[model samples]
Target: MSNIHVYSEIGKLKKVLLHRPGNEIDGVIPQTMPRHLFDDIPWKKGAQREHDCFADILRKEGAEVVYIEDLFRKSFSQKGSREGFIKKFLDKHGIFNPHLREQLEAYLLCLSPEEMADKIMSGIKKSDLGPKKQEDFSRFFPEEEYEHYYTEPLANLYYTRDPGASIGRGMSFHCMEKLGRNLETVVWQHIFEHHPDFAKDAPMWLSNESHFGIEGGDIAVFSKDVIGIGCGLRTRPEAIEQLAGNILPQDTFKKILVFTIPKDRKFMHLDTVLTMIDHDKFTIHPGIEATLNVFEISLGGSGELVYKDQTDKVEKVLTKALNLDSVQVLRCADGSFIDSEREQWNDGTNTLAIAPGTVVTYSRNEVTNELLRRSGIKVLEMPCGELSRGRGGPRCMSMPLVREDI
Candidate 1:
């Protein structure tokens, strides 16, 4: 019921949003897994159990958990609520032909609000919607071989962190580069713009119509006046500059540290390779610890961000930007190069800090979790056998909508 406020990544989380994997996971076939950005298909029942357990963990840690499905359902409770959302959902994906939109809308409206919401989240089969006279015949000369679902099941929606991020008292509905993920923003936009609880005062920083792309996993607000954004595979440097131009005039954050990392899928986002776990302590992957490109993004009087590329190392760059005396960096899977590579691939460097020193991570990363415990940090491990198939960890699965200001 309040405005979104997240000024620090390690602050005590107050409210968070997550999506419990449902029949949606069952919809991903082996043939379509790669196209949908999934490393492996997950068992639906087990995935739901894993997600429910994850939500319970957050709740026990004193955070209010809001399911994305529930939010959309609530937004649809009122009369005539489905009109705008349907239009937005269809148009955002370029399904603009009036006839095709009508068929989709009609199919969606027949069910109850909750069912309608679920159908959208679970995806739609082209066959289920019936033959569309409006269906494009130009591309079907040979008749597509695969059973193509009109709306791809968002198998990765469970990783809510990548689609959107919470900035200081606002939200950024990022324009994801992947075709499947672009729909995630459209779904959240409807909830934020129309849900009864958030409609009155939801502060949105970036629009869903943005051309340049920035995924939430790459952008982190470390403190009130200092922030860090990654320039990597999912998030381009141009998008970071555009985001800086949009955020600078607000003057809430004085400095933006652009950490450029390798574009390999192993280190797709900055948070995967680097994340702040406490005031002065950070979890790092050894692979990129010694090599990181650092740049300072700040406002110039000309209404654009003036970039100050730094020759200093990452630690020195952080110290300067965050005004820290000296920061401690803990490498993931310490000791063995092989173990480091293996553990980091399983998201060992990704930690969800509920409070300052207490965090949550996958238990499979034995060496990394032990390292976290040895560092005097509380480690809460969750079952990730089925959940990790989507290639996301605790931080990637949960998006803190509101957090206690540090």
Candidate 2:
């Protein structure tokens, strides 16, 4: 009955959170692609169509899909929530000038809560504020600063998994590694703090206020008592230690498996290279097998922190952690290194499991999809010609809110 109840990756999903691609996707032009964390600009309509298909698959499987924007709007339904949200938004992202801050606040407050929520996510351009004489900003910014056109857009928001993750009856709000994505968690913070349905009971495992970087994509719950966190480009060891300290002693969790992966954009997060598809089976990109290092964290008998450096292979690590007799490591593209590299770049290993042996992935990764099917997994594929432009697949775009314990 809890709002957040994800216990395992392959559980029967009951509810999930997603964000439809909006004008935010359109804001990614060539000049801003790197800053926005996109490799290419996605066609807005095509991206929306793809995202819709992704949602449709979840619905067909009996999972209730909720949009981040809708949840955010509901969070502001109270009398003064909108005003408070707008102030927080401006304080972190608005211009420093008092006059401009007042103008932006007035503009945002005039809109309905739903419209304001969309506007904030879509971003505010200087042009939206009407023509300001150069003199107006001359005192606040140098001549070179004028080249920056607008407030940073939440372009990466559609990959809703990075902002926060749903653990067992609780959620871990992240401090995203990049400036463009960090604000995304603020939206989640607002929803979890003010939305009546969620705010009433859901517990928070980690707060976004942490100085160290951590992302939802890097955290995966394997079972009720086990969690695997990737310490790589987007997640820091300090944050992982902090999360383990907070979660291990109090929750059902007994051990936190920490994977130190290659810190490269190509291997951005653990989910991008590895994900549990079934109780004893995992889908992994072969590219990372050579560089991956594993560790374990748990609480001692006296509630003191305990750490162990793992020496077994990744498969062995999982087998012992989950108490399984054996584990299957399904290589992406069935071990075709060249093909695996290409497909992994397109998120071949990022599969979202709605139930044991059932997953949703990008249709473009034909080799990987076929491999999953050959391994007795039900693979549902979604069109991702546009969605893949963002370099994420099904799992990266979804955050399971509730799942029946496996």
Candidate 3:
């Protein structure tokens, strides 16, 4: 087996990828908060502190923690990696004019690999691209478009799980639905294709170069052969079905459970509304307790897929998926209507299970975290005063890269 296996959500995490809030936060303008996918801005320094504590806890638990910035730095250290990345990065943002692209490349290439990576994440100013030539051409409509940057900083890159996911021995590099997040996956593609530690072990099962949108936060492995994906705001149902196309032929994964949740940003991705905590236990927001749409998909004979409508009650479907007689669905905020709503909005249910029955959650979600503890689960709390502003909890911040199959 490769070092990238993640056959189940509650597997023992051996290694994970995280991004510490960096200059991207500094580049966030009030005008761009919505574009950045942030309801409110995070205090970068405090968010960093909290992120450090999060990584420290994982390291203390024996999980090797890899970081985004470090990976990009290493990946760009190859002979012509920086120059190649600059061309693609500029071209992606619609800087098609030859002279403009050359100036942008020159500006970016002036930095070392480390600074080049950071600069791209932090964003380059419009003035930094140099004055546009008279012959510059663009498809952007005159009044409706153009900005200070050919490409804006990917502020949401810190939420590492949204770009891609690890499925058993393979990884799905997502095509993010939001333009603000698209380049984030580009950075991941480069690292996945070039980074020494990940290149060999993590095979690309899907890439955004040509595919529908699927975010890592919406994907969870139920077992080697069974997996669950959220058809949420950021993930399209077509994407999940297409992903099924990529995996169903292999013996490693045979079934996919697609949970179609509301398109509202509050329940943005699956992890925000539900998370697996144990072999037969889950933490879910009361808001989605009774109304989630479920569908079962599996490979049929002769390269066809079979589909079936599933029970609306997630607990019933999960029991069957995990082969358990019954599964426990614990409500966030302990069944209180108002508190549950508030905590769910605060990502109280978005817990990260590092191992069975153990999870990392935000300390501010006191009501929900307390309830998780009373249910015989070990809830490790991390400060999130600033981090929560991004509308994600622990699970949204980390992506498991190596896990021991339970």
Candidate 4:
């Protein structure tokens, strides 16, 4: 077993990993971007610039900003690693079209690590081929329209936080539920297993498998010894069980807290309702703090059992389990009716902490951000009009591997 570190959201981070938006945006047709869970198809170059700014912020703060593509390239350069990765991908997807598979393998091998990672994440363009070849290719396989079809790209790859969740000694790279998004997990596994910078130092556990599905967005590391898991559309109850089973035996974590939010499209994960700000302070929607039912599950000699006799409001439960006094709750504007509905639907409550008392959020959530700012929390704004179209906010875009002040 590797040394797994308990994450309390305030741990001093030495390094952080991020995936910047790539040409994958080009693969998303403007009409379908939202349904695929994106708002507007971002201009690749502009998105890159915006992402650079975010990276610069971290770099300026003295955290190492590791790029996903660089790690992917390093993994692909290793012979045994590349072959193992390609084999696993093809076998899992059941792609047996010999000639097509061979062609893709060759193309993949020819690409630099960055290009290969981009290709795997975004997909290769079919229309880029010459006209005569296109016509001949169409005829060669009547059923298949082009020489190669775009693998449904991992359009959500930029949201690294969804797959990287903290567990013992290291973090778990969650397997995605959506088949189209599976490639991102595959890439993560490759990087964790083969990337020189990460392979030796970073330990990873798999939470998503054929039978269980989990997403990182649904899990929150509230304290070094406590984890808050959100159960809803993206993560199954079984997945939660699997996580508890694997993590409980580890000495670092002492309790697993379960918060069941209404399974609405907007409340996709816990962060959608709750986020940690300063120590002992949290920003949450009133409904979640006051009404949601929270259960504390402890590991028993055999397995695990929920304390059926005791159930409490999320705030009280969290406060007791994590050993805190009071959690400062900030209500989004219009906490009564129409405005709350509109704001929550727009991901107004989802914010990511850069450091204690400092965070990033969507500027569009003016009332909510203002409330947070008035509370003495520094609110850094991202150009979210285009970003929000995808149904997630700042929290969704970032995947923090290390935070420096836990």
Instruction: Give all candidates' CA lDDT scores.
Output: 0.84, 0.88, 0.84, 0.68
Candidate 3 pairs with clashing backbones:
none
Please give, for residues 330-350, the per-residue lDDT of candidate 4 as tens digits: 776536556666777777778
- Candidate 2 to truth, TM: 0.96
Clashes within 3 Å, all models in order: 0, 0, 0, 16
Q: On residues 209-261, what C-alpha lDDT tens digit does candidate 1 reach at each position?
A: 88888899998899999889998888877778777776767748987999988
List model 2 lDDT by residue over 1-406, tens digit each.
7888888999999999999999887778887888788898889999999899999999999999999988887788777888887766665563677767777887788888888888889887776777554556554554443334456788999998998999888888888877668778888888999998787767788998888999999999999999999999999999998898888876799999999998899999999999999999999999899999999999888888899999999999999999999999999999998889989999999999999999999998999999999999999999999889888989999999999998
**Per-prediction TM-score, please?**
0.94, 0.96, 0.94, 0.87
How far does residue 149 in candidate 3 sit from its true spot (Å)?
Answer: 3.1
- TM-score, candidate 4, is 0.87
Q: What's the lDDT for residue 160 in model 4?
A: 73
lDDT per residue as tens, model 3, 278-334: 888899988885569899999888788889999557888888787889988899998
Locate the minimum summed-lDDT window of 10 residues in model 1: 134-143
Model 3 vs. true fold: TM: 0.94
Q: What lDDT score is found at residue 90 in candidate 2? A: 65
Best candidate, lDDT = 2
